[model samples]
Target: MSNKPLTYLAFIILVLGGGLLIGANTMPGDWYQSLAKPAFNPPNWVFAPVWSILYVLIGVVGARTWLAFRRSMAMRLWFAQLVLNFAWSPLFFGLRDPMSAMIVILGLLVSIIGFIAASWRQDRTAALLFLPYLAWIAFASALNAAILVLN
Candidate 1:
């Protein structure tokens, strides 16, 4: 077994994680601070670390799926969810539109489910890797909806 593929996976994971970190830099700033959040809203400091870990996990799953089944629907769904993931920050923070952000996140949730289902047959590990992401996004979607309602 050559290590070449593992190296490539690591490289891909790094790139994807970096991209997510960059995208996450679109912060909420004063606008977010002023909003009426739910009682369960986590402290501001919690988001960075949580999202960072989630992104890394997502990257690992994406790399695994790609390695297991390149150009397959599983990979496509993975990519699609990633695109939606990247879109949320801009829609919510940059544009300051929680309603639109909620829509995007809902789409992301769907895409993630699709990715997990597609990956299950090909690679159970990859499918399992997405569970945390799905849970987080579900939480985020609820948060987005709550923010939309509160503000």
Candidate 2:
């Protein structure tokens, strides 16, 4: 009776469920609506679906890292990025501080890149799984920077 499936399930729930819970609690609301957005700003409706998909990928990658590299730098970066990821919405929307959110997002971006690099040789599949996440975060970091400049 391998517990691997249960481990995968738990990791998926942790990442996806936690992200959704945090997102629900930190809805942008009227405050974000008031901000001067960049021309590239995505419609509000695009966020949920994108994040839902990304979170699932993130969860799977996270589980793979956990199972193979629990004591490695990839695992540490995974945790670091998750904390930063979970903090971004609250700092940005809930506290209405784009500056802090930008900082957090930058940290998240760095941690994500570090995770990819760390896991590349050790767990190439895990590293590969993070590519879309990397691209999205890069776009998001740009968006965060644009909002900071615009507003």
On TM-score, the candidate that comes out on top is 2
- In candidate 1, list every pair of residues with a backbone clash: none
**lDDT score of residue 123 within candidate 1:** 95
1-151 per-residue lDDT for model 1 (tens digits): 8765785568456746666665658767899899999988988888877887787778777777766687899989988887888888888999898888888999999999999898888899988988988999998888898888888
The whole-model lDDT of each prediction reads: 0.83, 0.93
- Which residue runs of candidate 2 sit more than 4 Å off their true CA positions? none
Clashes (backbone N, CA, C under 3 Å), per candidate, total: 0, 0
| Cα-based TM-score, every candidate | 0.89, 0.98
Off by over 4 Å in 1: 1-25
Record all residue pairs in model 2 with backbone atoms less than 3 Å apart, i.e. clashing.
none
Q: How do the residues 86-115 of candidate 2 rate in per-residue lDDT, one tens digit apiece? A: 999999988999999999999999999999
Question: Against the hidden true structure, what lDDT does model 2 obtain?
Answer: 0.93
RMSD of 1: 2.1
